[model samples]
Target: MSDNASFPHGPRWFAQPGTARTWRCASAPRQVRDFHAALTGYSPTPLTELPSLATELRIGRVFVKDESCRLGLPAFKALGASWAVHRALAERAANGERRGRVTLVTATDGNHGRAVARMAHLLGQGAHVFVPRGVHRQAVAAIAAERAEVTEVPGNYDDAVRLAAEAAAGPDAVLVQDTAWPGYERIPGWIVEGYSTLCAEIDEQLAAAGVAEGPDLVSIPVGVGSLAQAVVTHYRSRPSGHAPALLSVEPDAAACVLRSLVLGRPVTVETGETTMAGLNCGTPSSIAWPYLRGGLDAAVAVRDADSARAAGDLAALGVASGPCGAASLAGLRAALSGPDAGERRTALGLGPSSVAVLLSTEGTAANPRTVTDE
Candidate 1:
């Protein structure tokens, strides 16, 4: 409420109470952390406190989980990519499939492709990455830098995902997609499980910082909702039965989750170009929808200009952030201000003493910049 007047057509807020049940993880939190630890250059990403920003926002504290560098990649996608690949490979081995070099296949707007390629390179396997036409060329090059074959498809990300699924049907190929359809859920589920490592780390970091249960609110950037599902599941399933008020942020042009939440079912939207390239997804993952639909406290769609400003704000605080990453801040500003903000805040149980965690999903300029009409 401090700087609401300066906000442009801001921070649309939509929220409903969560009604979903919890799930049991396939592997325990310690096991997932151990798996990540076994990887090269594995360590917990930084959870930075921004007291100045917290003061500006008039909150107890604002903590950011920096994922700029995860396992040599410049994004958190490596966690999901590596763990999914490992599980996929292990399943093949268990089924008595011949041991041979296998190619990893996936579609990405950017980061996920490079991550899968990195894992493939490490495993002495091949990688073929498919990208939508709107994806930045630098992103394609980064994926290619891992020696993965890069293919530019005809339409949006969903179209590229279709082609990737087809290519992965080859006997020597394994599809490691992050989003899910009907029969394509198992791999994506493992990806979500992999992302549990992030929330698990957040718990440890918050405990180390002396926040016993957790922050009152956690703002997460949503693409296809896998990571958001992971966050929702992690907090809701806590042994102490304490969960944070989960908020999801997305690009206005592709707010599938927000739209789906409003309609009480999954729905797809036509996506357009935006600077938040990593989150330019048109559809929500079907498997993730159930968890998200029942667990999210709020969902917000932000403009490119708003996200850019938030990124700059983070930069001034020495937190390098891209549009997708900084979107958490943009969404937070709207959720705590704008229309019905006071009522919404009360419903979410947020107050001056409430702490908030912003999940910064990427580093600065992870994708090429795009022009947008402010």
Candidate 2:
């Protein structure tokens, strides 16, 4: 196989006749409203300006979308996966699937698994989550607290995903997977829609603050590209006359999205070599591919060192972040340093007048063993 080969793995085994149809799904305004309502108990995560970091980089402005407080989940995955599973359960109930007990299943490196477990527990259903072998102990414990059964697969994230899909297909289980391929499209799309709330809130907050246009650039991390797709979708659909350029970042070893976008298809790469464990994805989700292919403006792959440094920088600035969450800032930092980065900045008309946003997608507590490097 080529180093950049794209892998297609999913429920093609049991896919119905229409399973291979183009998987294009979007969040309805009403469903989005319902999702927001259900999640009201979650504190409105703060969007704070990183004045100190901005000054040091001489970037016009920088803002951090702090997701640490999301439903006490400490990760932004709570918004997407949990809300998606909730919506899925409601839909199943509408279809009479809830007359009997329904279970949701998925595989994760960590946070998405926890979100699925929490949603299952809250909705009176059971969940069986498959996790990668090297997943952190704390993350596993957190998922277990949601009362979900956790099984460790003997491979990487992609391997766990394969196993989950296999199990969910057997019998009456509902697989609320974040990555879509053949038969599964609706649930993953719902997950992406749930994440749209974050960007919508950012736009409203910035507008209310008297910033007419949106940020000059927005950076987000990629793990199967769901969150990145959500941000891109929201900006593309934003009513604002102007939208910021979207940049997606990933760890060097798991830059599958970058490779996929370049080749115009989903690709798989190596795993287990990056410290940004949350972004240690091998392939981009089929559900998220079209959004990244057309909606996002750029993609960057940064070294583990840069991501680690960003986590440290965030911690120093009173914003706690793990390596995966800090990958976006590392992309921003690289975009500021390279020669073409200057041109990209100029093309975006960014100067001291421009404002930028970086998404801190997880709390440092997710990886207690990962210390921020000085």
Please estimate how well model 1 matches the true structure, expressed as its whole-model Cα lDDT: 0.83
Q: Tens digits of per-residue lDDT for model 1 on 150-266?
A: 999979999999999999998899999999999999999888888888988898999999897788899999999999988887877655556678889998878888878877889
Q: Which pairs of residues collide in candidate 1?
A: none
Q: TM-score each candidate.
A: 0.92, 0.87
For lDDT, the strongest prediction is: 1
The lDDT of each candidate is 0.83, 0.75
Q: What is the per-residue lDDT of model 2 for residues 1-374, given as tens digits with 9 covering 90 to 100?
A: 11232323211001112211122334335466456656646556778887887886676778898876677677877778777877776787797763667778999888888888877887788899998877777788878888999998888998998899898985569898888887788888888878877877787777766666888788889989999888777677654367577778887777888777666678787765677877889989897888787777666778889999999988888788888889989987866665465655654446877788899988866344222210
Off-target runs (Cα >4 Å) in candidate 1 are 1-11, 18-30, 365-374
Candidate 2 at residue 249, lDDT? 84
Error of 2 at 223 (Å): 1.2
